[model samples]
Target: MIPSLDWLLEQADRKLKKEMDPDVIAITRAVITELAAEGLPVGVAQAFRTKQEQDALYAIGRTRPGKIVTYAKGGASNHNFGVAVDVFVYADGGKRAEFLAPPDPRLKQIVAAMKRYHMQWGGDWGSFPDYPHFQLYDAVNGQPKPLLGPRYPGRPLFAGAERMDRTLIRLIQKRLRLPLTGQFDWKLTQFIEQFQRQHRLAADGVVGPVTWRHLFGFQR
Candidate 1:
């Protein structure tokens, strides 16, 4: 028996709610709903990937035996930050997923729906056109930046770190109203410590889950 669109949407929502950022979840749902209204069977294929999972995917065609499927490694893709999702078209009575490439007519409608929600379609990429991918966009000077509050980096950030994800650093700097140097410098550390102290948190100049929650106004 063919699954109904309501059932498909419910399954997609269950997947989307797993680890996706709240704002992305809303926009994805809205996009899916709009497409469904037009009788397009679209659903979420992947969302909010972990760094380890991303690394494994990156290994494809390089270390692993499959074709190259992704360009971004761990912590580099928007999926790691919960701001990206890959969608698929339902087929075979909604029992199979079809990741259509470009030059397909349905892709235009899907792109339009994603654009309505301020999302950047990977299909539009100049080099690696990923037709199944969509991500929220907030560019700065022609560089892509995440649009939602970033998920915790799974580790504390402090001064003297070898390397840090510039996106998170920039978000922290913006929140603190400091220079957007995208660095975990001593000045940024001091500001984070001060903000922690003001919020009755530990003043250790570290950005862990608790401090991150406070920094981004997350309740949990």
Candidate 2:
């Protein structure tokens, strides 16, 4: 029941074919396979849910899915671009459920397993709450960041939409605070809006609920 080796290859962005040495891919696959060894590795699910998934699941403003999952749709989501993935839970009786819709207890098990594999849990992605997603991260010392350097030195994002200059934005935010807004000499509204786009925040400049909360806890 292990995932097909080819499926893992699709999970990576095309640029990965250029950047990732064969050894790197093998190492990553080994990691994921090893984590699922205890359970039946039932093959890889769609790495990232797209706008189509949202459309299918939502009849009204409310999500038809059992759990609150995913905030990003299409280009906005890390998944649509292939940076994240969802895993299913397998127990006895040969039952497997979508990780995104799995019960809470199962979600915890997946998270623990993901942590063991050194993947970042999407549940860590702020209050929006995503229990079944994981993304890879690389870091040295105590700082965690995208494995590829700025502009993805070797690996690049899939197709369109700028990769979002995370390092620069993070640097500016860290070096400067609310006062940094003054550095731009732009209206507060515009500043917040830009910040949001750069950091993958919802682009609403009001900073009403989620935006302000992330800013507060965000380091510097």
Q: How many residue-pair clashes does candidate 2 contain?
A: 0
Error of 1 at 100 (Å): 1.5
Against the true structure, candidate 2 reaches a TM-score of 0.40
Error of 2 at 63 (Å): 10
TM-score per model over all chains: 0.61, 0.40
Instruction: Report the C-alpha lDDT of model 1 over 113-175, residue by residue, as the tens digit.
Output: 777556788877889788898887622124564444456787788887757788889999999
lDDT of 2 at 75: 47
Q: Where's the lowest-lDDT run of ten residues in candidate 1?
A: 138-147
Q: Measured by TM-score, how close is model 1 to the native structure?
A: 0.61
* Candidate 1 global lDDT: 0.79
lDDT of 2: 0.46
lDDT of each: 0.79, 0.46
